[model samples]
Target chain A: MTGTVWDRGEPRLAGPDTALRAELRTAAQHASGNVPVAVATDTAGQVLEGMRGRAFDSAAVVAVLDGDRLRGLVTLERLLAAPAATPLGEIMDDAPPVVAPSTAQERAAWLAVQHAEPTLAVVDDAGRFAGLVAAPTLLGVLLEEHDEDMARLGGFLGTAATARSSTTEPVLRRLSHRLPWLLLGLAGALLAAVIVGSFEEQLGQEVLIAYFVPGVVYMADAVGTQTEALVIRGLSLGIGVRRIAVREVVTGVLLGAFLGGLALPLVWALWGRADVAVAVALALLAASSIASLIALALPWLFHRFGKDPAFGSGPLATVIQDVLTVAIYLLVATAVVL
Target chain B: MTGTVWDRGEPRLAGPDTALRAELRTAAQHASGNVPVAVATDTAGQVLEGMRGRAFDSAAVVAVLDGDRLRGLVTLERLLAAPAATPLGEIMDDAPPVVAPSTAQERAAWLAVQHAEPTLAVVDDAGRFAGLVAAPTLLGVLLEEHDEDMARLGGFLGTAATARSSTTEPVLRRLSHRLPWLLLGLAGALLAAVIVGSFEEQLGQEVLIAYFVPGVVYMADAVGTQTEALVIRGLSLGIGVRRIAVREVVTGVLLGAFLGGLALPLVWALWGRADVAVAVALALLAASSIASLIALALPWLFHRFGKDPAFGSGPLATVIQDVLTVAIYLLVATAVVL
Candidate 1:
């Protein structure tokens, strides 16, 4: 027998609210209450008769409710395949995957994917059924988030619309999307110039030290970029930076050592200046090792502050890495060469 | 009256092939042919009875077939709402979104999303029904492709598996994923060093030029990275580079002019050298403008060769931008400052 089944009049589906849709992009915002619902004791034939004239946002699955609470879910396929006299409760999935209405849109979509459920159920704090996030909405969220992440990682303002319009967007709109990040990058670039200017004395004495600046900065950025991509993807999948920080930093150091070992002899053989070679190799080691740390740390900070972690990957993080790489390269050059 | 219909005996579904699944991830590879299928003339009651005893990979949508040829599709909700004697042809949607079995998985998923359909039908070259790609499979494909794009854009070897395993992956395995690109980056870096070395005479005469090397290179890489991300996302969305090339290059030049205008006065005031400032500003303009051209071209070449265009975004493009920036900076400095 079904436990505590209470009928609450007719099953009225929730309708879209344009005002609420304009708010935070949460599960509650996207969850549509327009799906079909049935009472547990209803026979398949009875439910089918009731559904005949009603419109549903999604009819793939039906929520079986006991009063105001969700009891289980039954896919329409199951309902069609069952005997006409079979009770809804007998064919319903009693433990379908459910999330609170406050869940992040990406997290909600991810849970649906992990559960391999076509639609996700959203329940309220008081354990009342809110609605279901249908397949199309879930698909839209995934694509939108993908576009946003790529835009943020590429240094464009994080707008889902930007990704779609970027190809055909007028040059002015494209500039508006790309300029904010580049301006920030320019400030960091000037700061890098200041840092190098402070090291002009050493460079004036040993002009060879200047030759490796671009090389060193480029290598560190390459290493840091790899870490940023890994961390961003991991974070979106519900893995935190703290979980992978140690291993990632270690990978950075090992990579530095490998690259440095190769560079030391190569620079010495090509340039025939052992001190310059040592400085360049050592700078590569330090810059590469620190690159991953900064990469992981910036995203972690952004995540902690409730910003998109992907914002830490592109222009902002690149500038930070460039400044630090220049400082490390010069500080090491001054130490080893002069 | 319904169009010409042929009967092809029993509706047997295609089974998974392990060998084929290991090859190129395509629509055919992930599609499940085990979905429910019914002839157009079958009654709702008859189709329901036929589906009762059979197993289906996905029962969300039933293919309405004319023999082996697809006639239409019917969601379970419509079938459930119909009278028992209602022929499926009356309820079936004759124009459901569909793709060839050889279509790319991403394209198939996009079609499903565009059509707002939970499932996609796949047909063979000769137009026989091949399978239905279920919602879950489409969701998985989106997530997998997202991870792969992030990995490739972040400069990790382009492997979908690498994105999932990177967080918990052992350090050695991590190195394997990261080193191939870093080695290529190192070669590029050393080449940058050679480019800088060729400018040693200019640097010794005016050591101030060395101060802007990191700054200029960083800015160009930042600009180039934005275009790369835009181009990569655009390419995946089926927008070819040629469509956006003129507008993108124009945006790049405009961005360069804007950044250059800002840098010129600031450098002159900070360093009190108009020649060095002019060189820096002009280099900024030239480097920033060329960055987008290289960014768009590399990815276009990769796409033309049937490679994943995401590869053109990260270390490869960055190094090319860096080398060119350095050469442009010194060339401008020699022309203006000397």
Candidate 2:
């Protein structure tokens, strides 16, 4: 009778001022309309029953009491739903859910669900009920919140360009969408092979470099990723400062040391030369330590600067780490093997 | 009287039922404290008087209406704050905010706010007022919520490593904690300059390459990120399989076209050389588009494989994008410049 329930499947009230026993009348009206409801107070039960199964007159008054105030609401359905013999002392709720009158319509909708309420009782400074907010208003608010979250994410990444052309594709149609491009990796290696063919004299003299390439590349990547993983996790969790600074840093050092130590023996076995082993060990230790730090720092920086922390996590880290890793490897190779 | 408010400003409901109303007292003895609340019917004046100047009893009850089964609840502080002259009808907020029984205790603490009325109400189905959840219980729940949110974020990111050391300074410790990091893009750029110093010779030989460096690296990064972002967002939001694959791929293609056009002109201006511009333009266009599409595809693959989308977002994007960008650039340069 109040209205349809698109708002959150909750009932609605007219406003703050109903005459005494207003609730009772509201219930009776509903019952006449074929919906049964339990009246809260024993005081209002009889008047509702008196007109049992009959349509309630809107102007008809009913005697009622709920806790301390008198309400003008009365409905036949409410009367039918209540236990016929229950005492008035046993049937009323104490406090009702409410919101401020000035509350945004959208926010009000979310509150109904998050706060788990039916009608949002509007109130004033002294906590007096001013009016009621319907459920549909609250639903609108929830949808708006969702939209805002999406917007922030879109802006942080480059969504506009992506949306424009390949509005249907995943991101952008570039070298990757086609199978021809997948062969590019093979192409790069094939080119590398051709380049080495021209430098056959040098490569033949230093054939061991090939064995070191995979380890060096993989190690650099692993260290970089491990660090990135840590930093991103820290920012998202709101981890305490103490842990981020002290504990996280200590962990990076320990991990670097472990990795450095593990790779030293392998490097020595591969080249069987002290110079090569020392260079590999030193590079591994230094790069691992630095990469871990950068990974952690990058995310923290992004979060601190209001940049997208996720942005700090992936491509940037790899760009800096890989480039540096490759350069470091080349430098050490020059220092030792050359 | 119940306990006073806590530091965080939430009302405190202390141990056990004492000084509570009759319905609450009865439910406590009979319902074994499992029920949500108890109800009673009275005038607004009586309801106010019962709650006036005194805290609601610890064993307070949630309330509902016998009239139309509307819900309302009260709490101890609300009762104490209630004005004697106020009518219950104007203040009865039938639907009190409620939480799941299993909610964290810490979060529950702050959640207990009494706009009006005395006794936090707890209720169950069939429109019955069970018993009060009590302020103290809620406070405990609130504490638990904070911890839970932290743990959940960690799990979502899917890692537990906290960085303990860095190759250089602990960037998060030195900077992130005090403020944000991305805002210092200038500083990040300067730091990048220091990194580039280690490879200045390589950069100077092909200054044209320098102009295209940012454009190339960023474009590849943008493409990869766009793809990942869309796929991840879709999976998280629970998009259908068809929608994700079709929508994301199309989006990537569009994004690539837009970026490629911009990069082509920029590289042409920077290099001022016909062949270099054409080669760089082709490379940028291809890499940008492909990187984005690949990035987009990975998220769906991750979901299909039951891996996290955000997991590989950072390190993976950087590596694939950088390697391809660098290799392509070098190859294209060889094909044209040489």
Candidate 3:
């Protein structure tokens, strides 16, 4: 037996020669009871009739092949609106989305994102039909990478199939998969601690400054995450959303202006230092909102570069946002308050 | 002649029947040269022969239906190791993921984050297949809601599709859709800033304390953003992670420790106060990391609670993190410097 490279410990590929019809027949022949029906395709005429009479739902699709060569497919959905006299080709979407064998998993994921479809047309290196990949499968890869433990958490699903693949990974494997990320996070924390301590004289001068640290950081994080989420969601859903990506910046600016409006008064009210509040809020709001726009900009850039946007999260967005945020904060404080 | 009530501005439906097949044909007809291939079900033998011959790109899938109801679907990727003679019913995965009509745009956007092959089988009210929704269409809805005024500034997609619907409407519609959320954030920011600023007397007692505010806040934001990015990405990917949402908290603690270590060394090196440096670094690291974790944790919590995680970002995460961060910073400063 060949060693299967499993995704989430479930075999992702069976073998090239696997056939469902024969397997089903054999399963039916070998065992008894509750045999599933064979799904078939419908021609345009048949589909139309089915729809006209409202039986299209019962119809599946089949490829009307000529011997062993080329042919078109017929499905009830396409058939319903298809003219009774029209041939399958005339009504068929002649060119379909295709995937190649040499295509990287990430590439397939890119196709899934670009086509805005959950599935892709998979072809071999020779441009031959290989197999199709659905969006969920691609998503599964991401989830598997996210948490060895989340596979057990059932991440927004109720199915045993996905559940099994997600949750069945052994503890050791799960730990191995996730531990590195946690360790990296630990390292990041250390770096941050050092930066803060290095500036102790500055902090020691202002105890009140310490109280705002968590809130400012949290706010910036929230802004960055939200902006990133929006842009990514936009990118994932709309393949050519470079236009939307830019708009995110504008939205961020507006959000900053609005947030600044609220933050300024409150900061002043809380500290009874109107000048400090105005200065800090103006800078903070601008940083927070703009950070989100910048954070969200990556998905489009990654796509333009033929990279996977979903794979990046904690590594860059956080670091960049933090550095810029600090610069803006200090600058604003110096220019306005100091 | 009828409008597409569901999307509001879909290209005109080509025909009358609202049935899935009819609707798809209508869209296809309207699209003409732009019409892509139609994806439909294929019997087991057809699938085998197709793959063996390298026919169509494995972009299309074979959906298994039981009397108009979706049983499961098989994609090209699934066929690689599948038995050559199996019936699709035997191999088809039943209970595939689905999307309901009433699902929010944000939720739909989030769902698009699946890494595996994912498809949303649009079903009619009867739970029968209506049509397939590609991810782009869903994301387009949100992008369309975005504000765009200038081409260079990202106001439009530069596609003629916008001509189909009056831009004035979506913009106006957004006022209602987005204003409330912005207001909520504003209120939160205002309230927090006011409460915090009221402590001006304490800060005035030590003007130096104000100088550290910006630096400490930026550190927290940086950590929080990273955490938020991870969680957002994980959720979008459908990773079954659960404990990590909480377990991630440990990331802050560990980070704090590292930062504290550095802070102690740096402080002693810079100011010749080993104890103050050590204490402040420890305090800053702990507070900073905690702020980062909270920034991340809150969005997931909001998403889990059925709110848009994007909407969850702006005020709440920052306000809460800052509040806690400030308290921590104040405590540390008073204990050591005051």
The residue-level lDDT of candidate 1 at A68 comes to: 67
- TM-score (0 to 1) of chain B, per candidate? 0.87, 0.42, 0.55
> Which residue ranges in model 1 land beyond 4 Å of their true spot?
A1-24, A36-54, A64-95, A125-128, A160-162, B1-24, B38-51, B65-72, B81-94, B124-128, B160-162
In angstroms, the error of model 3 at A164 is 10
CAPRI category for model 2: incorrect
What's the CA error at residue B9 for candidate 2, in Å? 32
The C-alpha lDDT values of all candidates are 0.82, 0.40, 0.43
Point to the candidate with the largest DockQ: 1
lDDT of 1: 0.82
Better of 1 and 3 by TM-score: 1
Q: Each model's fnat?
A: 0.72, 0.02, 0.10
* TM-score of each candidate structure, all chains considered together: 0.88, 0.41, 0.52
Clash totals, every prediction: 0, 144, 91
Which of candidates 1 and 2 reaches a greater DockQ? Answer: 1
Off by over 4 Å in 2: A1-250, A253-281, A295-327, B1-222, B240-277, B305-338
The TM-scores, chain A only, for the candidates as listed are 0.87, 0.44, 0.57
- Sort by lDDT, best first: 1, 3, 2
